[model samples]
Target: MATEKRNYKRVMLKLSGESLANDKGFGIDPEVVYRLAGEIKEACETGIEVAVVVGGGNIWRGLKGSQGGMDRASADYMGMLATVINSVALQDALEKLGVSTRVQTAIEMRQIAEPYIRRKAIRHLEKGRVVIFGAGTGNPYFTTDTTAALRSAEIEADVMLMAKKQTDGVYDADPKFHPEAKMFTHLTYNDVLQKQLAVMDNTAITLCMNNSIPIVVFNIDVPGNIVKACKGETLGTLIEGE
Candidate 1:
């Protein structure tokens, strides 16, 4: 069969830290990371520039800590550190597959990864190296989702690929609990906002909306889905301007 033409030359992949975890959802699973890396390597082979922003929820959740009475900033900093760890692990997995990769952290950690530099990151992507962004924008009170949005705009990505661990796409309600829920294949930014869908936080959604970057929200566990998403084969909910 002939391959479909790719719609995007560059993309920002938004991943939750839980995507790197095992079924227990508490720690990094080497097998899972390796599988994910292999898929990413496939996407790179297609010549698409892929950048990643991974959350740290598997290791720590800053908001949860703050809710438990910890200083919010300190807790958020700890969460950033967790993302660094996940980024390093993913970098290792990708490199093992013979894919050149770079880990850039918003918060500087000279010994572990390079500091985030916009121009340098774009250069790396241009050279076919996958760049993993860690540390969640180097600030407290910002999510990795927001980091993905911010970086996608700065790097001029064609689309934001949200590889969700939960549902395959945006739906009217939680499909897990509501079997009759409807999945939307496409949506407008205003529809997402007005319906209060949880596709992304409002700030992240607004950022993409303002910049006119399309977002694809899809399930990550299905094998080959990542490559399909990169090729724009239409597997999930697509959010863009009307």
Candidate 2:
């Protein structure tokens, strides 16, 4: 029970849906998922326990439901399903690359994957298996970011690695739009919440703060960054911890 004896024994990684897609937001890109799998495989090779929370922005988003006026809960449920699709694609990609992975859905599709059971998920990680958590928190109106925080707390993950499509670190403004947005190499959770820095939803940020979890926000486009960041490399902004 030596706490796994890793530089980071447990890590919760969050990947945006767009990160898994190509230029068009239609389907999963095999190459991107493969590369991501490689990065995660390396981390596991180093004895780092991994769990992933992937988004579904590429496939769908609850917020963008047509003006026909879908209920907020219904739209959010649709978003949850979208995450399941991404999870299935990711699982296939990882297996293709010879990496052992599990997809646990909050919504419970036993034929496809196991339900999200806290003890079971932790056991998977303890066995050095990568666990992919899908379907958002089994709740509506919550983003995958909130799922990351909730799961990280439950599994006692050492860090939450948030992998973005672009922009390496937290910035004062969107670098894509504002050429001079100041990038923060480091920050506190308060900075993200109080300042409304937009790293994640207010609920997610508050959850991390309450749980005292450290978070690293970085760009996922960098092939090996997930592993590097897990080993405590200075790749992006570290928030909310000593």
Candidate 3:
């Protein structure tokens, strides 16, 4: 039987740190990670390249640290480290599921994982290895959302998939708090920017707009959503430029 054609050849999956937590609480959740890994493996089996960028909010929120009187840069660096930890956990989970995976850090810790190398990462994806980018661009004050946009551009991914925990898609307001908030099925970069949608930070959204990369925001709590997004099934809001 012939395999179904995929909408994207390569995709970048952006997952929030909280997504890895237990019961929507803090810290890494093994079951959640394993389930997510299974989904990723299924997507990989579809013959498309997969890459991921994970946030550090579950372990550390740099902005909150700065607000609490810590040095902004120091707090941000700590957040980066938190991301590396999440990446390591994810790498282990994916491997246990029989998926080939690599954790490349922007801030080098040669003992733990490989340093971020553009060509090397691309080569790994081409060979069917999932590349997880950690350390948040190795810079302070840059959110992992920007890291996802930057990495997606560098890897030339067909689309950037933003996986939210419970939210279904990008909405006019906080859907949880605002019962009347409207969900957008499709939007242009300008629409996201002008409307100041929280789908991503302006910097991240701008980078994708400039690079002509589209973004899909969807609820990851639903099983198989990741694979569905990779298959271009329109599971959520799609943001693109005209």
Cα error of candidate 1 at position 120, Å: 0.4
Clashing pairs in 3: none
lDDT of 3 at 211: 99
The order of the candidates by TM-score, greatest first, is 1, 3, 2
CA lDDT scores, all candidates in order = 0.93, 0.86, 0.93
Off by over 4 Å in 2: 1-6, 66-68
Candidate 2 per-residue lDDT over residues 69-138, each given as its tens digit: 8888899899999999999888887777777889999998999889999999999888878899999999
Between candidates 2 and 3, name the one with more favorable lDDT: 3
Error of 1 at 21 (Å): 0.6
Task: Give the distance in Å from residue 27's predicted Cα in candidate 1 to where it truly belongs.
Answer: 0.3
Residue 106 accuracy (lDDT) in model 3:
98
Compared with the true structure, model 2 gives a TM-score of 0.94
Q: lDDT tens digits, residues 1-242, model 1?
A: 21244489999999899999968798999999999999999999988899999999999999999999999999999999999999999999999999999999999999999999999999999999999999999999998999999999999999999999878999999998999999998899999999999998999999999999988999998999998999889788888898
Error of 2 at 136 (Å): 0.8
**Each model's TM-score, in the order given?**
0.97, 0.94, 0.97
